[model samples]
Target: MTSAPITAADAAVTSDTITMPLEDVIDPDEFTPRLLALLSNALVYRESHELRRQFKLGTNEWRVISALSMRPGMSATEVCEFLGMNKAVVSRSVTRLQLRALIVLSDGPRGSRPLYLTRAGAEMHDRMLPVSLRGQEIITEGLGATEVAALNEVLRGMLARIRSDAALQGAPGSPSQYPID
Candidate 1:
């Protein structure tokens, strides 16, 4: 059966006919996506912050360390590709991690390229991995396995759509579809 139309008064009240909570009263279309994004980002930031504190490393350094943990020796370009980051940012992060003795860079076959991660980097990653897993568990506590899978599929589809639209807009000679930033 189709749902009934929502009136302003119905939207403002709970099932018990009492005024809904402030969060519940907000317009869904106006605030749901923003709220969800902010909440997701906040959780990520909090976990990253805790990891940094435990490992004595910044977010960028942690990313480099984590990348190296997966593979001991990766070039800058490889790391950038894995992390979806630009070269300049990766270079700066690598330099800082190297200076801190968390990672060591050795010359590679191609023009003095560096392969990264020291013993300290591995240790930090090991220490923080459990915490990260715990954080993830907490975030997904109420979600059933099926629900989690469904959410993942939905989010992936949304990301693909967004990326496809962006690419189409950025293609040259496409009538300048979107106003360039």
Candidate 2:
């Protein structure tokens, strides 16, 4: 069965039928995609703010550290490809991380160097884990385990479908990079 068109007329009003103007009745919450995107940005901003205050790390740096923690010894280009970030941003974050002594570079063939987290970096990542997990807990506080699992499954399926369609279309520029599974 199809759902009714969401219109201003559906809103509650007096029995006399005075209603809100149509232009003013566009509820943002009804747009699932935009709502989800806004929610994602808000959550990211909150977590990033706390991470910076606690660890003096920007979102880019934390992304690099998190990526390296999972897959150690990734070259800068590999990091960019893996993270879907441009070369310049990743390079700058890598430089900052190196300056902070959180990452070390090891020489490879043809002047290529792979980045590895220093002992300090690993320790810092260990400390940051719980903070990230706690942010997740806060967001999912009202969701049951089954609901959480279903949400995850739906999101993953959507991502996979979009990625597959993009690949097939081969739309402009470089190919898109996906999150590590």
Candidate 3:
């Protein structure tokens, strides 16, 4: 999808009815949602690239590992809930991690299912946390502490709103279920 390009200066106009160059005024019918989608896609791509490079993990893999790190020995169901991921995706990630010797499965004493991270998994998590935090710090360094806090709050609110709306619309999944573009 293409949008009429609006320069930064053009976007700063104050008047509601300011006359823009022909190239700046995109057709509302065709441009608005597409432009929004383009921005969303770009952000997701950039974030994913950073995650892949810094952590050596895809977005899905990171989600699974992060969830396990937070609460070791959680069942797949627990992971799905905690990560807001689909069962299949979590299952695949777990399988991959197990194959990579990063996680392990055991039987509970009472014969119930067991879920957990291996020592290697814990070590990997510890190793990756600093890198992830550094990436986050880099991304937010331009913003003041208060601005960063506000940004977090705003993003959380938006996520909550979207989740609620999805639920009301009878969507099959939660906010995090959708792949990032």
Q: Would you give me the overall lDDT of model 3? A: 0.73
Kindly report which residue stretches of model 2 are placed more than 4 angstroms away from their true locations once superposed.
Answer: 1-27, 173-175, 178-180
Cα lDDT, model 1, residue 117: 67
| Positional deviation of residue 129's Cα in model 3 after best superposition, in angstroms | 2.5
- TM-score between candidate 2 and the true structure: 0.77
The local distance difference test score of each candidate is 0.72, 0.83, 0.73
TM-score of each: 0.68, 0.77, 0.65
User: Worst lDDT window (10 residues) for model 2?
Assistant: 172-181
Q: What's the lDDT for residue 123 in model 3?
A: 82
lDDT of 3 by residue, 12-109 (tens): 66667556577656686688567757755765566568767875666677667777777877888778877777799888988888887888887776
Best by lDDT: 2
Give the Å shift of residue 20 in candidate 2: 14
Flag clash pairs in model 2. none
Give per-candidate clash totals: 0, 0, 0
Write model 1 residue lDDT over 1-181, tens digit each, in one string. 9999988866765577755466546676688678778777887787778877786666666677888888778887778777766679889988888787888878777576666667777777788778667756876789999988887788767666655687766744232222211
When sorted by TM-score, best at the front, the candidate numbers are: 2, 1, 3
TM-score: model 1 vs. ground truth = 0.68
